[model samples]
Target chain A: MLSPLLSSSIKYYLCFMQTVIIGSGNVAYHLAKAFVLNRIPLAQIFGRNENELSKISGELNIPYSTETLQKADLYIICVSDHSVEDVSGTITTKDCLVAHTSGSLPKEILKGDYRKASFYPLQTFSKSKALDYSKIPFFIEAENEEDRKILFEIASKISDNVMESTHEKRKYIHLTAVFACNFVNHLFARAKEISDLQVIPFDYFLPLIDETVQKIHEIDPKSAQTGPAVRNDTRVLQLHEQLLQGESLEIYKTMNLSIKKMYQLP
Target chain B: MLSPLLSSSIKYYLCFMQTVIIGSGNVAYHLAKAFVLNRIPLAQIFGRNENELSKISGELNIPYSTETLQKADLYIICVSDHSVEDVSGTITTKDCLVAHTSGSLPKEILKGDYRKASFYPLQTFSKSKALDYSKIPFFIEAENEEDRKILFEIASKISDNVMESTHEKRKYIHLTAVFACNFVNHLFARAKEISDLQVIPFDYFLPLIDETVQKIHEIDPKSAQTGPAVRNDTRVLQLHEQLLQGESLEIYKTMNLSIKKMYQLP
Candidate 1:
């Protein structure tokens, strides 16, 4: 018969195992910090950039490296879109579960002599702002049953919202994210530029921005769309076009026309 | 010299006079409710839509109307884009401070044979959701000196951030708001559609959306932009195109190319 003390000791040993994070970018930095804050031991952080590695290590008080991938239960690969495949090619962890944190790239990118998976945090990140990972959604994808279970277990520890998704679905979600976040932000920047040039206070636009966002939380955006474009107020549109005489004007007209066409509003 | 009893009565009467709101659209509804909550009495609400007028009147316990403009200290015209001229055309209240709530249309749209100005709330409004008017910016404009002061005083009663802007400036601000709010929301809707089609939970994209907006408060949007397009990850871009297909694919490619060209990212 097994002793109760021995069984308890085994459980404790398993719970104390370290987690390794590969690649040192925004996602990696935020994830590592969250793990450390949660008191989960961060075994190592591996990457090519010594400066970034050092900065992350110093900030989190975690170990850093520009060396080979360390053996751990899980190794998270966080890198740029192009760098994913190249970095995956370097890791030789056949037994350890390896995952990449990318929205668009497929899990096949990690195809090699390894137990591969994905732990995509569906969010934008910046080095300047500290993220609340608990609020972030984690999308987990794996090749097999056991690996998938392990990946889900790990992801669930940090975030409240965790789910299993295939690469095809994740890719579609990523494309949508590009439109929603990146493209939308670019639109705001363009708007800011136009407003600044006219010497108008940018704060004037914030109310509209806040309302536009708040509206969709309650209604469909198609039904929620409002503007001179939606109304096809030709006189106002023409007057606006005349005022904004540049590249931005062209963009404005194109977007306005698109909105009008979408809604079939004149 | 005035008698003490008569002077005290007049002071009490002036203090008890309530501000009246004209028209029962989104702006009028929100403003009226806000005024009521602020303990500023909403003496009356007027609109052609009897159902809407009665609903607001009943909810706020204010008087309802489908009648012509009555004598009031302030008259705010909150109507559709095309109706601004028609609605204000009949008013001949030279003594009353008159204003219109429109971003694109000028204050002169209310240039009846009266004191004309604008009380344009720089925010989108829906009939369903209650808005915090204190957070919403108010743009004040007037044709003459005395009317401008009255407009400013009325606006200051609700919002803290009030500004004097020209018609040309307000028009440009409205145009910029189209990009920031309406256009951005369309992109979000597009993203949501794609994600829904792919069977991914819409919640997955919320983190990304929240972060992108939060980042803007910290840094310039030009610096905050991220994703495969900004990084010039052509491989991921091609894969994204393959996944999107048809018009969405075209939109994805066009936007990606535009972002790449803007940043000169490779």
Candidate 2:
């Protein structure tokens, strides 16, 4: 522990780091908004899409540019994974820390001689949706402890949950998100497709979908599990499989088999 | 369209129909609680599980019995699908409407001289969890219009969403539930398994899980889909596939293939 005066000065130094965001997409928009809401001033938002960038700048009241990059203590590259290297290379600011906001890519992928870091917010972002920023978990990684502390302090201003994670752990985090978020949504689409066959309103399934998610918060999903696959109900399983065809049939059979195998049901 | 005097009497008749619930499981517990909360009088709660029944009775102040079931105008069998027929047979009340609260089973499965029906509440229930009964969709099917109206009125008291669904449609509804609820929960469990290996706290993933579900309420899940599968990022896909083993790996591959095929991606 340090003296009270020294700790306050150190906190001021951590919070005063000038930051610039590079992108006009969902993640960039949400991040900029969160920072603005939290009173963390941004130097500029730089992106190629002029129309989208202008919209964000207008809504967030943050300065935007399409060509010239702003000089800042930290630059968060929020562009696509493929574009991260190219966008990072365009930054000519020397001795400044640069971080990319991506789940799958490592910090080393940033093509810059300056400090490299990752400022990953592990949640899905949509431009139109209002998020509770405090609940979102931010995973920070940096080449050195000084930059890591900077990123973590900035993140801590907007979110309650923040941690420093390695590139290896972040890879699995992204993979786990694929299974939990993306695959789960696809299943919802498939379920809607089936319900639509009989003109059953897809809205009817929303409560069950909601409760399924709510259950796991309290109960371990394995113990909370229910339905045909877990029960090994052959009669109902045969009926459901016959109702599906082509890719739907494939998914139904595979998921049922997986669930049965997981539960050790023969 | 009817006169107010006759219509009020008809409404009175519908509301006055006495309801008896059978069984001592999640469905039974939730339905009983919902009915009591809505001020809908239950004649008695009948079930063989005396311990669970006493707990429900003690909390709800509703009469419970392991052997004798009170005579009522309507009997809603809320037992397991396998025990539904046998429990419905146990009801010796003459000329009363009998219904089983099941998604998959047909109303005709009830073996009795009395009228048969289905009063299925489409939701996942747990004894420990509190639910917004108004959001749960009630699918009612009866052999006659009078019984249907009675159930529709009773269900309407507890839920805002009540619909007359056919037994055929109910099967599809049940099957849709398996895909949307059970299989989706299984994916959440798998996600936890992966995250647990990296020693990542599962709480961090809850916000993502919530947003995935929240996105669909506004956007169709197909258009809302994200991740390596939808992005067609073969590198990330390969890495994720390599991280998983046995059933998890099989599920990962099958789900990715299904998502790719649905998107018409190579």
Choose the strongest candidate by lDDT: 2
lDDT of 2 by residue, B1-266 (tens): 34577556657976677778999999999999999999988878999999999999999999999988888888989888878888888878888999899899999999888999999999988898889999999999988766777788789989999999998999999988988999999999888988998888888899999989999999988888877788788878887777889888888888888899989999
DockQ score for candidate 2: 0.76
Model 2 agreement with the true structure over A1-266: per-residue lDDT tens digits: 34577556657885676789999999899999999999999989999999999999999999999988988889998887778889999988888999998898889988877999999999988787788999999999998767777787789999999998989999989989988998899999989989888898898999999999998899998888888788788888888877889877888888888889888999
Q: Please, what are the lDDT tens digits per residue for candidate 1 over residues B1-266?
A: 33576545544544565456778888788888877776666667877989999999889888978986566767778888788888887666666667788888877777477777778788878888767777777888876655565556556667887888787778877787877887787777777778778777666676677778777767877788888888877787788777776445655765666677668766
Which 10 consecutive positions of candidate 2 chain B have the poorest summed lDDT? B1-10
Measured against the native two-chain assembly using Cα atoms, what DockQ does each of the candidate structures obtain, in the order listed? 0.60, 0.76
Task: List per-prediction Cα lDDT, in the order shown.
Answer: 0.76, 0.88
> Which candidate has the highest DockQ of all?
2
Estimated TM-score per prediction?
0.90, 0.94
TM-score of chain B of each: 0.87, 0.96
Q: Chain B of candidate 2 versus the native chain B: what TM-score?
A: 0.96
